[model samples]
Target: MPSYPGGETEKAAYDLATKGEKLVMDYLNISIFDVQEMPIDLYLFFMREAYIHGNMRTKEGREYLENCRRMEQTKPDRKKIRKKIQEQKREG
Candidate 1:
């Protein structure tokens, strides 16, 4: 149900979502169905704690952090997308 502007912006959004989903699933050893059916409030809270605060303490968390770094290194377009988001925040 989520919609995004077309082209690179949309692609970037999907790419980011895929990465996040993978991180959550891998960390929890949960299926995609679990993530899909999770309540929004719980999902947000879990992700915030597991993905951010969990960093370097657990194996899964450390792997996720390393994967994130690798993603940023390989995907140069993410930098542009980030800048655009920052500009939008400033304008809003």
Candidate 2:
């Protein structure tokens, strides 16, 4: 994951994606935890809809953008950490 270098526009995109995910989950009667295991195709479809149709200037949208930023920053780190753990286990 990397920072939203595009500033407000990138933030808006991330916010839209978050809102889209939530809406999809709620519509499907799924919990937040279940989202992690959601099918990528469905996720992408929902996110695309969100970006294309969602209003990114709303208050909730802005608030959730922070989460988007945090997730972006940590995504790559999680993979790297997992790889490191696997390497350590192999060595040990």
Candidate 3:
């Protein structure tokens, strides 16, 4: 995550994740995973926040942000997960 010089980084990370979850839910047309599922979102979000912070700031921040941007640009493969959910429903 983008560690700010002060303690602001934590809050920035949290906000990034929260926004990411919302985007995921909307774009994927699925329910948010439980607490356990949120970790993925949190991880990706931290990277994204770090990247944004890095872009206009220090060199370290920029490097971290670039890495995060690369990660955030990736889309999750939902086909398998959706298929699995469908199968469970069929069996149940």
Best lDDT among the predictions, by candidate number: 1
Please say which candidate is ahead in lDDT: 1 or 2.
1
- Flag clash pairs in model 2: 1-76
Would you estimate the TM-scores of all the predictions? 0.40, 0.30, 0.24
Residues 51-74 of candidate 1 have per-residue lDDT tens digits of 565566887656666666655565
Ranking by TM-score: 1, 2, 3
- Model 2, range 1-92, lDDT digits (tens) per residue? 12244434433333354665586676566776776687888777765555433435677565556655665773467887899999999999
The digit string of per-residue lDDT tens for model 3 on 1-92 reads: 43423423444433454655555555445565742365676647654554464355777666655555555656765897799999999999
lDDT of 1 at 41: 84
lDDT, model 3: 0.56
Native-referenced Cα lDDT, model 1: 0.64
lDDT (Cα atoms) of all candidates against the true structure: 0.64, 0.60, 0.56
What candidate 2 gets wrong by more than 4 Å, as runs, is 1-17, 46-92
Best by TM-score, which number?
Answer: 1
Which ranges in model 1 have alpha carbons more than 4 Å from their true place? 1-14, 57-92
